[model samples]
Target: MAKSTTQNIRQIITKRFNGFFVIMLGAFGLLLFFLFKVVFVDGPTLKADASSKYLKERSIEAVRGNIYASDGSLLATSLPKYRLGMDFSVFKTSKMRDVFQKNMRPLAEHLSAFYKDRTADEYYYKLKSGFEQRKPYVLINMRLLDFQERKTVLTFPVFKLHPKNPIKTGVVFDKVNVRYAPFGQTAYRTVGYMKDKVRVGLEGAFDKELAGVPGHGIFEKMDKNMWRPLDGNKEILPQRGLDLHTTLDVDIQDIVELALMKSLDAYKGNYATAIVMETATGEIKAISNLMKNEKSPTGYSEFVNYAIEVSENDPGSVFKLPAMMAMLEESHMPLTATVTTGGKYTVYNKTMTDSHDYGTLTAQGVIEHSSNIGTIKLMQRVFGSKPSKWYDYLRNFHMLDPLDFQIKPVTGKPNFNVPAKWDALTYMWTSVGYSSNTSPLHLLSFYNAIANNGYWVQPIIVKNATKGNEVVIDYTQTQKRDSKPICSKETLDKIRIMLKGVVESGTGNNLKGTPYGIAGKTGTAQRRVNGNYIKGTYYVSFIGYFPVNNPKYTMLVAMDKPLGSSEGTYARQVTAPVFKDISDHIYARDMKIQRKLSGYLPDSLNNASLHHLIHPLDHSILYANLGFPRIEEDGRWLSFQLNKKEVKNYGLSFAPKKVANVVGMNLRDALFVLENQGLKVRAQGLGFVQSQSIPAGFPIQKNALITIQLH
Candidate 1:
């Protein structure tokens, strides 16, 4: 009975064990089927989902273009700056904690000594707390550090200890770009800026070219808050914008600005503007616009570009050029035609006046005297039969058109449209520059046209745009705007003659004794305030070119509401003197003008000594070669006095004349004198001597250095 019971138990155990094995096999088969389905059908979707969560897209900013002066000096550029911060998470480890605690005090003291902005105790506690809290980033300072400063900070106690090894001290830097002007406030407006998403000046106008195209890249998440750029197939390199070469002459611009500022300070004017342009090319060399600062009653600073923007009033007597041109072209009137003025004269209901009483004068004389009544009489006599002809002349001269400059913030346009209701006195007012509104630039363009022999070329502020060293856009190489001649050559010549007379004997007479001849007009007109003429407020202006026989530059200077005595309020007093000052300065400095003046000398002696005394042989050779009247002088030393008529000679009594007045001499002459006395010369600047380190008449030292300043 016991053997039978044992066999039955063994059979039952076998059956149960077999059943459990079958169930396990079925479960394994089901799992394999699901794995195959997922791998084939859902792989792409799952991978995309993972990428969406972990991948990042980043933008790479392109480098903006630079602005350069005509001579290739940097005007505006972008500089990269960095903000330094520390990652305190590295100090979380016990080892790092011990190291940090050991160096904490020294690091804090070093930072305090270097930055001098915070106490050591304060820095120590702040840094220690940041480390304890395991902060990722703690700012080193509120102020962003430059590259050199950042490099210097890397040498500090803790920062220098570990760079690649973040466990010692974690350092981080965020880069930023800032616009920098090497020449601050010099042509600031013309160089321009972007503010509140709006572009101003050249920056605004050529933004498309200046702002380079942006690029893109892909990055992958490496940690909870850290992202690293993918190794390959991730980045698009950004392109740099092209550079701009402007027509501005920095030296001339500075001179013009200083001269304008001086006049503004002297007259206490509301504002002043001056522009210098190349006569034939219409390239603007220098432009300055300054306004008196109300807060600082005696100081003046740059405000709006008054030369090309402000157009509230009719140009004063400067408009006389256009009126005179109209009469000369339309009426075929000779410049000799006469008009009489007795201080005041009337046209219809309006009475015009001259500053001084002139009984009768030629049309040329009328312009020279700047007589409103005389100018009106001539215009009426010429344009009375057909008034519209006068307006047509102005239109043809381009006085009614926009300058269409390439600069941003477009230049202001003049209003020369005919009135709906033409009155009898309309011609009279417009003839004397009282009815229409125009900017100083507009007036300058017209005068430049006259100097250009009646051909009107558009004024250009920028010359070209370049990428790297290659020129991408050259304004001069592009198709030039068609220049129209405003009048016959003969008429233009006559106008030029009259303009010269104005400088020689008329309104601009104060500029007559200038080193070079100037031909221009002086304008004085009452400025209108709130649509009413203000008695004391006036616009005084002088516009002309130098070396009258062969014009090279045309300039315009205008002062608004100049305050002072009557004489100071006149154009000759306020603006003419400024013009003279600038012209004299330019004549002394411009290499082209100097070369032209040098051409007056014989070619054989073109590089002759500029010393006070020349060798007698040189004098004879210069006179014989150039056909100048020769003077018989037996003296060992000869001095030359150059006049328009002849080069005369005066014998110098040489007896080691103790360095007489070398302060105002030219560099070459100063050097010649100083070196002749066995002294070494070291000079700064390019023009006449302004100051000397060694006093004149001091006993000379052998080969001693003498410093001289020129301007």
Candidate 2:
């Protein structure tokens, strides 16, 4: 009787549980149906409504900081740029339609003339189409305009303010900040950029300091789907980012860039890197890593920071300097120590030889001539029995350590293994700038230490910064030495002498006549491709300090795979000349360098240097600002010689119905001329156009494709 009662009670409980589950399932299904309706059926309408009128917390973008050169010239900065839009919906009204129709043609003509991007008929069609379709917001042009352009654009007929109904203007714009370098692409990599929320170069390195704290504000949606802060003022004011004061010298940077471009143009190399640093402080005055870009309007572009990226390069004979230091420090070899170098030596059945049979040479003679045979002979003579000791000396010079550079994480560190890993092949090859992968920056540091009295200072880019008051930051702490001594004073002096001898008499004699006395070494290493050395390809470099006695600056010029014969690809022939040109510019600009020269440099630039191919407007602006008389000239571009008094202009003429010659014109002027003719252009390279696919004076065609190459 008790079991029967229990079964009845369990049956009742099960029925209740089943009923509850059914009810929950129905309720969940209903809830899901409602969710589906909201998400799929009415999602767009709801989202539009939410974005159109909702009062919500919105972020106010903080103004990013500016980057200034050491001399306070603006290098990189954010400026307000606006994309123009037209509220064509206003033209739907009968009274507004009359005004728009009457003024639209004139407005289109004015815009066509002002922007030169489209024909008057096209603009009229765009405006007419947007109005007929009742577009709430119609983009006037895809191009962004500066503040001055914004003000100027309002003067157009349909865009100008109405006497009472200001809304009749039908003009609108969205504001955004654009990152620009005032000096064009100069120091582009160093100043850096942001794209798709990813930052690079100094911009990436100092993003936290440069990107200020953002603040929140209550915002309400306005007509045309735009949001406005609830109040005229922000609820929380955003702090502007701190400005960075960099060690870059704009003039020096220009000099370096131009010199490297010239070298790249002359050598037809795949790429090149040039760096100039302050000797004592290790401040980077100018750095350039230009690479070949067949697609660029200029044949070259700065896409990689080759200066610090990888030590993929073998130091070649440049490694001899460190070897010289090692031997001087530990081996105590005299400059007069002799070695028999018949140009070939073998270690572990692997042979090493020089370009020339350097017969027999003293220690100094070996370095001066860059004799590979002599170098190997001397190293063997000193540490041959225990070649492992050779590795110890290189390690002491910090050759084996990572640069840990500020700009980029260095890779392919000088491949120095522990003594246990030393072998005949490794020792022989490593002895002559092979086996170890070393970067231009790391290799430069070694030379910098010698110039800096043996104190190895880390190379730095930023000088200081400021936060609010002046809107700047003080990053201005002194750079501490990375190491106390690269070598003893005696060793430093001996190495310095040997390096000077390299410039004076060695393979680097291509730069022998430099008045300031360049103390550097030249290196030429056969480029290894696919793990094998190529027959004719090469990587060459020249690095050293100038004015040997004073040691004001240290520089490195490196190039890879320069074209032409093997004879023309040597470092002295291809790289050292560029070093000389840059140094000459520095010597001319710096008062201290001039003082050191005792009036050796000319007071003014010669006419050869002054001759320029530039847009006339550029010179006009420059002359106007400098209080010099402007030349009476009008053309797409101009060639001129700047003298103290009169301005000279090599005249230019263009036919309205022909493709304008843009070979000597800059990218800006070139685009202005070509695009105005309704041509579709694909431009590559940088600077003045070198060639145009469509010959000048070819009959202009609307929507014809044209390509221009620059260098």
Candidate 3:
């Protein structure tokens, strides 16, 4: 009976064990099926999801290219700057605790002295509190510091504990780029800037070339929400932008700006513009556009490019050149052909007059004297027979179209078509610089054409563009925009001769006494407002070239709303002098012009008159040799006060043993001293020296080129 009962219990136990084993096997099989599905069917999707959370694609900004002047001087560039930070958590470490205790006070004091914006005690408390709180990152300086400054901060007391190890030093830096201009406010408009995503000047025109391609890189998320480049990740290197080599000559630009500013100030003008261009190549050497600031009592700043942009009004007497060219070519009229001008003459019920009256004048005298009546009468005689011929002449000269310059937009397309109400009066009005709209640049191009012997070349501002050392765009090699001969060489020569007469003895006679010959026209036009001529407001201008024997440069100076009496507002009085000032300075300082002068003078006498030129150090020697008495001394540098036959030296001394302070010396005196010191000079602008590359009292290096800026 006992054996039978034990057997029944064992059977029950075995049955229960077998059922549990079967359930366990079924569960294991289901787990294997799900694992296989996950490994094969959903593997890529899950892996991608995980990677997205840990890795990110980031942009690597390209380094912007530099803008350089024609001579390779840096105009605009990008520099790297840094904002400094500190990890106060470093002081919580046991090793840093001793360093903090020993140098905390000294570090605070150094911070106070270095930045000068906070107190030592305040800095100490702030640093101590940050360390106690275990602050991960604390700003050390709000103002961004340069690379050198960042490196310097690394040498500061507590930061110096680990000289070469960044992690140990606990110093942090955020790097950024900054656009820098080496020449402040010089050609600021032309150099341009990016505002509201819109580029201006060269920066805007060549944005694609100047702004390089952006690259891509992989970054991994790090502690404190920081993102850093992941080790072994691929990166596409960014391409640096191409550099721009503009046609601007910094020295000539300085001169043009100074001359324009002086004229604007002297005349109290609302605005002024000046441009200088190479006649043969059409390369713009210098350009200036200045406007009066309404907010300041004595502030003038650059606003827009008026030389190329403003083209709403008639160009005044400067237009006479084109009219004269047309008449000479079509009519075959001699320049000596005579006409009568008795103060004024009537034309188609309208009256025209000259500034002054002459009994009888030739066609050449008409332009020379800027006689409106004479020009109208010549136009009537030449084109009145066939009125369409005048329009055809202007069309052939390309005066009816835009110049289409690459640098700036040009306005003012002339309308030579006859109006419905047109009559003989229209011809007369358009003949003497009225009833036609043009810009100063357009008029300059006309005069430049004459200088180029009738071939009109399009003006160019940018010379070329380069990537690294390879040129990507060569403007010189591009298709030339030069026009076919606008007229025969004979007509060009005749008009040029007449223009010379104007400068020599006619309206531009104020420029007659200059050492070099000037050939240009003076213009005084009534400013039109709301389609009506405004009284007493005029646009005064002078346009021409120098050394008429061989034309090299063509310049234009125009002033709008010059504040003065009627006589003071004339082109001869206001604009011609500015031209003379620029021309005289360029003639004296330009090495090319100097070389040209060398060919004219005999070799033996090339520098003969140089000694007569005064020198500060040689004052005593010069006066004693000339049998004059020594004068009083007031300063180290000597100057002379000449009154009649009496000559007196006012405290003149010898040349400075070291580099002298020539910041206020005139061009002539500055050139003498600098050249006498055996230093090569590069001078800009026309006036007293405003700045010098080499500071005063530095040892002069032989043959070193010193740049002097005048204003």
Candidate 4:
């Protein structure tokens, strides 16, 4: 009877259990179906806010690329930082009130010391409020905590340290990379800046390659408002930005910046610009713009990029290089051919004037003096009957078009225009660098063509680019070397020789003795503002290169509205010295130029004597109010105060007496002049003047000894 009763009870219990299990399984299936519908189909159909909560995905931050200089020095880079926060409830502190305020005080103090945005009191208030509100996780520092500070915080009692949480914080710093410019504002404008955290300029143009693809990771929001890795997190490896190789040399860039600053400051000018390039390959070595911001007390810091930015009339005589090139290409005239130029001449019944009264001069002489009248005559000879031909010539040289560089131009029309109602003299004016608009880059490129033996290669900023070691730009073996004959080699030779003559005997005479022979032209044009030209405003410029026989570097400088008188003379007077300084500095460094002369210098030094040497052979002696005097056996004392030109010219003079070592006097001034004269100067002192080897009147031969002491 007992067995039977037990069996019946077991059977009844088993059936009930089975029925409950089936019902539970059915309920679970229905719940799963509802979840699927909500996630896939119904989710999208819901209200915007509801849909966002269910369907919107969190973003993975993209990794930024490293920026490098031409030689691969990391200029801009990203560094790692930390993010930290805490879950107020999980900090299991047993000492309740006794330790709560003490621990919290230190934490608040840490926050105060690290972050300047808030005070310790403010941090304490926020922490208290977060606890009162039952906030799950609270953010402390937005960036990485100091290593020492983080360590100290971790040792504190009951501070459940989740390197991801309090002290270190779970805010997910994730070792993110950000952009940094080491040479701050060096080439700031040209390199461009970030917009909304995206790179710009060379960085922006190639952002696609420089900006690496971001990685994704799956994470779940914790109950405490913190994030933790999901059980099976899906992730993608981040791709790094491509490394870019450029043609820019930091040394050359330094010279350009220095010269630009000097020009802007000296003239108290509105703005200034300078560019250096390799003549043969059309590689842009350096480009600088020193503009004046509106608030700038003096007009030397405008955000405008005068190199490519277009405005009417600011680019003064720098336009003449291209204008002259157009005329030369159109009119097959001899360089020595004569043209009559007065101070002003009428063209198409419109009066035009040369910067000076050049009278009758050869075509080459016109360039030497930068004669406006002569240029107009040349234009008339070429395009007077057919104005469109001048345009065609300019088009061939790319003067009327954007350079098509990596950087897009910022400005108006890309062509030089002689309006439909243009007169015969309009072409002449255009030829003389008037009635047109151009960038400093346009003129520099045109001169570069002349230096390149008429070959026009496209100028580029980035030499090569890499994407995960794959060459994107391929500058090394796959260099984009473009070559085309825009003018005859004979034409190039003539122009080059004429330019050398300008430096040798004409307006650019200041360029003589510049170690390497320079072939270039000077330009001075009046500023035309609001339809009328400013009488006194002048843009003085010089564009040329060194070792004219085998042209290497080509440079252009433009200074706007140089103060004082002398219309077109500013370049030859003010800018040419700077040009020489830049040229000599570069040729000495990269080209190994001095190596070729090494053997010769040693030979020259052996012949120089010290005893009979008074006034070091290469030491330029200057007397007050006296321009420059020849240093004979008897040396004249130099004036303490000296201008750049007078002092520079004095250093170029060789001693009339025997060569000796100059061991005393202004070492800084002496070094400046000696370097300019191509003489080596070594110093060992702190102040000015101490002792001497060369007496005041000794003749110091070229490349002679000059040692100075500062007392």
State which candidate has the highest lDDT.
2
Q: 388-498 in candidate 4: lDDT tens per residue?
A: 777667777767777667766656345466457566556667766677777777777778777777877667677777665677766545433446777766666667767
Global lDDT of model 1: 0.77
Tell me each candidate's TM-score.
0.74, 0.74, 0.74, 0.71
RMSD of each: 12.0, 10.6, 9.8, 14.2
Q: Candidate 4, overall lDDT?
A: 0.63
lDDT of 3: 0.77
lDDT of 1 by residue, 471-552 (tens): 8898876524445687888789889989999998998888997666899999988888888988767888999997787789
Cα shift from native, residue 473, model 3 (Å): 1.4
- TM-score of model number 1: 0.74
Tell me the spans in candidate 1 whose CA falls farther than 4 Å from its real position. Answer: 1-58, 89-97, 113-117, 162-169, 218-233, 293-299, 478-480, 595-711
Ranking, lDDT, top scorer first? 2, 1, 3, 4
Which ranges in model 2 have alpha carbons more than 4 Å from their true place?
Answer: 1-56, 86-142, 162-170, 219-234, 294-297, 385-389, 410-415, 468-473, 476-478, 595-711
Worst 10 contiguous positions by lDDT, candidate 2:
600-609
lDDT by residue (266-334, candidate 2, tens digit) is 888888999999998889999998987766444567887888766566778898888878878877788
Position 585, candidate 2: lDDT: 82
lDDT, each prediction: 0.77, 0.78, 0.77, 0.63
